[model samples]
Target chain A: MISLTDFLIVSAVLFCIGLYMIVSKHNAIQILIGIELMLNAAILNLVAFGKYDRFNNGGQMFALFAIVLAAATTAVALAIILNVYKQYKTIDPGKIDKLKD
Target chain B: MNLAQMLFYVMSFIALASAVFVAATKNLVRSIFMFFITLFALAGLYVLALADFVAVTQIVIYVGGILVLILFAFMLSGRETLNAMALQQKQFISIGKLPAFLLAALFLIVLLNMIIKVDANNLEWVKKSIESKNDIPVNAAMTEDIGVGLMTRYLLPFEAISILLMLALVGAAHLSRKGRGA
Candidate 1:
């Protein structure tokens, strides 16, 4: 029997890794990758706990919605990144300080 | 050390290792490939957790749709940005990223502490579910149940998400198209 704790630990580590990627990476696409990782970690948690929700399948349903939302967010973010690159000629988030007032 | 437990460990290792690579690697294209592996491994973990439908959805939507979109964006972006080799070489552990490393490590330690403190196996609802045999069986096919639920109980969110996706698609297309000045 694979305990729930095992799954939780894996996702926690994954989430932390994603957080590190988001904070440390200067590239916009790399940050998007990190966002995806964090979302996957949350989805993993939902599915793991959903195993116990036999009656409703709530966790799985929410995971589906979450995945869709992630896709949508990624699309929007990529589009914005492209626009930013166009205006600034670089994709490094750290260097794009035009909005810094 | 049952078969499921062993398989779970294998999948978890694959997912985490690739995720670490994705985070640490300086080569953007290589990290994208590693991210593919990470997503596939996570899909396997989802199956092991008895979310068959979700696992398939993860593979289909994530691998087929989102990753391809990301690749398209990568290709469309300027070569100067894509060619990240000359910019900086990022090691797994480096002095420049010390603050990020420390923050992530601290967050992991706190999360692990909280997870360990929660006795998930002996929780009241979990024990009750076990006693009543109300948990999902190991071999249950979740696709049909999920489909039914989507049409019935989750109909609102289902419809709402479709609308949201459509809006996002339109917004992305508009944003990515050339500006009037161009």
Candidate 2:
């Protein structure tokens, strides 16, 4: 039977996979996908913990806020990435090195 | 296992698989589509976990609002052929492979160890808490409670978020206009 521990384990694995993607990929949009994965991992943990929080549903509420914030952040980040593409003509973040010191 | 347990496992598997796909896919459009699928599956899991309101909000805000914005950004960002043709290559740069692998492995080990250390004895306490809280059970029908809570205790934050959203909308429009040289 699946338990909280199983959920936590899966979330942890997902987080690691996301981190790996963020570290390895140079594409801006691909990096955004990785960030989304990491956010989803945290949301899963919040909901799993909410299962035990029978009083106030605090964890579930937090998950809702998290989902909204993730979407908002992604929208803004995409806008920035689009602008970056306009200036650089490419989405490879490694090659968009105009600001690097 | 019962039907609920079976469904939980199915939904969880779908969520995890989609999450992995979101990370692993190379195409930007495909990755965003996978992200939508992942969010949808997570909403289903939220419903299963007895958070119906949260599930509905997830659908409306994420699927309806944000995904549209992302697609718009993708379309409006100019010279699509250039981005489409540029191929990304994997290069091991300054960040060494050994350190990255070691850090991720260490994070996994620590998280698993913590989960394993959770006392089984606490299971009975949790069950008892669930049982005794039946009088004030926060079930699917707690929509009224949520409304009341939002209006009363969370009024400031709710208003603040609305302001933030308005600012974001204005800022996005301004930035996009600047991009168009208007």
Candidate 3:
């Protein structure tokens, strides 16, 4: 019998790791990965809590939408990253100072 | 412990360990592969949480779709970036990343504290659900229920998501395609 707390702890750890990745990683793609991780963590929380919701299944439904949105966001982000690479010839977000004026 | 509890721990371990590998590994390709394992483990966790449909969706969309997109982006980018990433294998932690490490540690501590304070086992709704036998049972078939809810209660947001997906598809294609006025 795994309590909801176990899942919450796991989700929290995952969220922190994603936050670290987003803050520390230099590459844009790595940041995108971190964002995915964070979103997954949130979705995990939703599913964990949804366990108690027997009738509506709202958590699972919301998780589905979240997953779809994550996919869409990832697609758009990667495309943007590709263009950034093409323009700058580097994916290191730190060096892209074109608009830093 | 029971089978579900054991499996739950195993899946969480796999998910966390691989996620750490994905975060710490210097090799971009290896990290991506680790991410694949992470997503699969998360799907397993979802299954343990009694979300069969969501678990399947996790695998199909995350492992099948997103990972492939990431790999394609990696390939299309260039070799030089990979070389740059490979060269940074000397130190996992440095002064430059100290702030990020601190922030993550603080967040983890706060979240753990909150979760511990909440003590989920004694929650009012959980107790009520248990008393009424309204909680979702293990190995329940969620697909039919989910579909019915989507068509009925969640129909508007479902249609909105379809529109959003279409917009994203068009947007991504347009952004990635070469423009003439460059």
Candidate 4:
């Protein structure tokens, strides 16, 4: 039986990596990938907690909803990124700073 | 280590390594492939945790649907000028890179500490049988429970999510039209 600590540790690492990507990457698409990673980490945690909660399976339920939302979010974000690319001719978030001072 | 623990470690390593590649790799196409591996490995871990239905959903939605969509967008964006510009030429020398690295490190540390420090024995959600025996209820009825829950108590959110999905797809189509290019 794998311990819950193992799951938690993996998720924490995933979350941190996602944070790093979001912060350091200049590409808007890459940042969206980071967001997906972070969402996966959260879903992993939910399933881990669902192990003991046999009565309701609330964790699994939330994970389902989260998965659907993540899919929809990726679709919309990629469309937005495509639009951004059209406007700037570049996907680099740093170079497309219209509101920056 | 037993088979289960060994599997867990292997999957975890694949996920983290692929994620690092996704974040750090210069080639965007390579990053997307690596991201596919990361998501695939994560789904394997979900299976290990016995969230079987969620595991299948992960594979179907994330791997099959989203990754494919993202790849199609990449193919569409593959023009000469855009292709030349798409390389992640910006290294870790960006102004905020150091702060972001520090913040990620801090977040990992805090979460790991919390996970390690928590008394699993005293937690309310940690049922007595689970703590005493650590016996994961590896049963077939798990999917049945999920189905019933979705149709019964979770019917509202289920319908809402379907509606949200349709709207998002329509909005995405509208946003990515060819004439809107400026």
Candidate 5:
């Protein structure tokens, strides 16, 4: 009998790990990976809650949209990272301090 | 526990572990591999959650499309030394060690408390709704219902998302082609 608490706890752990990764990693691509992880955690929670949504399947549908959006975001982000790499030789985000406010 | 519960636990563990590895690994290609594993596990979890449509979307869009794009970007980008383990100064101790852990713990506690409260109130409503429902032949009915819903209630949003996607494509092309002279 896996409880909802179990699912939520797992999601929370994943989100925290992702946040830590995004904060600590110096590479732009690594930060992108962390963002993906965070999105996955949210999707997992949506699907888990969808189990209780038998009527409209709202959670399931939301998760579908989320998956698509994530893919789209990742594609755009990666492309931007490539451009960043072109402007700066290194992918280390710390080194690309040319656009500082 | 039943087969479904066991499968859920196994898939959840795999997804969480792979996600952690995706964040932790320094090698870009290795991180991509971990990302695939994480996506696959999430797809499995979606199936387990009875979101067949979402599961397929996850597999096709995330695993099939985005991951391939990520790998392509990695290969096309001229940065070869990115896979090297580049550690920041006081990597474990500076900025992330205590604050992240504390924030995570506090968030977990607050979220759990809110969930417990909400579930207590909503559980009976959900259970009652499920109990009253006679099982429809879902396989055929679900697709039709979803199609109708998309066309009727969600039509505006659906069309809007398509437009957004198109805009994104154009924007990406424009951004990338800036200094390349078409």
Candidate 6:
């Protein structure tokens, strides 16, 4: 049988990778992808822990809700990214320095 | 190792590797592809974990809905791939580079250490996990359990999420719409 440690380790690796992307990548879309990775890591944790709670299944329910929320968030975020690209003519977050005093 | 353990490791490696590539790759379109790989691998992991509903949902919603929408946004943005990859490796090789790597490494080490140091068998839940009674159901219906729970216990959150999704759609339409105002 697969252990919860396996799941946790995977999530940890994914979360760190997502953090690296968020910190290193300048592209707005890449940053959004990083955010999704981080969110998926958390959702993975929820489902992993929920493996034991069959009577309640709260964790699985939370994961379901999280997946829905993630989709909604990505839609709004991508739309904002598109608007940024429209205004700045570039999707590089480093170059879009309008608010950076 | 058993077949389930083997499958878990394989899927996890695929998910982690592709996730790293999604962040590391310079080609934006390639990153999207890598992201797809990562999500698909994660879905596989979810299945191995016996989260069948969540696994299928991840594939349908993430790979189908969000990914298509993301591709559409990229197309609408009208960025040529050549110009997109024009941003050099300077940012990656800069002063903040090594520290970021060290930080991520440290975090991974800390988390792994914590997980290893803790005795899983001692936990209240882990004790029961051995019985396999409360574990994922092979015969039980997830649809009924989840549906009934959502209606009776999680109804408020369900309704709230519907409202949230509606608001998000409206906001996305407004934000992406052209020539509204400054």
TM-score of each: 0.94, 0.82, 0.94, 0.91, 0.84, 0.91
Please identify which of the two predictions, 4 or 5, would achieve the higher TM-score against the true structure: 4
The 10 consecutive residues of candidate 6 chain B with the worst lDDT sum are: B81-90
- Cα deviation at B109, candidate 3, in Å, is 0.3
Give one digit per residue, the lDDT tens place, for model 5 in A1-101. Answer: 45666677678778877887776777777788778778988998887777665556666667767776787687678778877766665666767788832
For model 2, state the Cα shift of residue B42 in Å.
1.1
Could you tally the backbone clashes for each prediction?
A: 0, 0, 0, 0, 0, 0
Ten-residue region with minimum lDDT total, candidate 1 chain B: B84-93
* Model 3 chain B poorest 10 in a row by lDDT: B86-95
Tens-place lDDT per residue, model 6, B23-109, is 777677788988899999999988876788889999999999998898888876565533654654434446466666778889889
Top DockQ model = 3
Local error of candidate 3 at B139, Å? 3.7
Q: What i-RMS does every model get?
A: 1.8, 3.2, 1.7, 2.2, 3.2, 2.0
lDDT of 1 by residue, B38-118 (tens): 999999999998998999999999999899999988786657656552363442336559899999999999999999999
lDDT of each: 0.88, 0.70, 0.89, 0.85, 0.71, 0.82
Clashing pairs in 5: none
CA-based DockQ, model 3 = 0.75
lDDT of 5: 0.71
Comparing 3 with 4 on DockQ, the higher-scoring candidate is 3
Q: Which DockQ-derived CAPRI band holds candidate 3?
A: medium
Error of 2 at B137 (Å): 5.3
Chain A TM-score by candidate, in order: 0.95, 0.92, 0.94, 0.93, 0.92, 0.93
Q: For residues B10-88, could you state the per-residue lDDT of candidate 4 as single tens digits?
A: 9999999999888878777899899999999999999999998999999999999999998898787767534544545
- What local lDDT does model 2 show for residue B65? 81
Give the TM-score (vs. native) of candidate 6: 0.91
Identify the runs in model 5 with alpha carbons over 4 angstroms from their true place. Answer: B79-98, B116-124, B134-141, B178-182
**Which regions of candidate 1 fall more than 4 Å away from where they truly are?**
B84-95
- Writing each residue's lDDT as its tens digit, candidate 4 over A1-101 gives 78888898999999999999998887787788999999999999999888877667788899999999999999899988887776667778878779432
Model 1 per-residue lDDT tens digits across residues A1-101: 78888999999999999999999987888899999999999999999989898778899999999999999999999999888877777677877887732
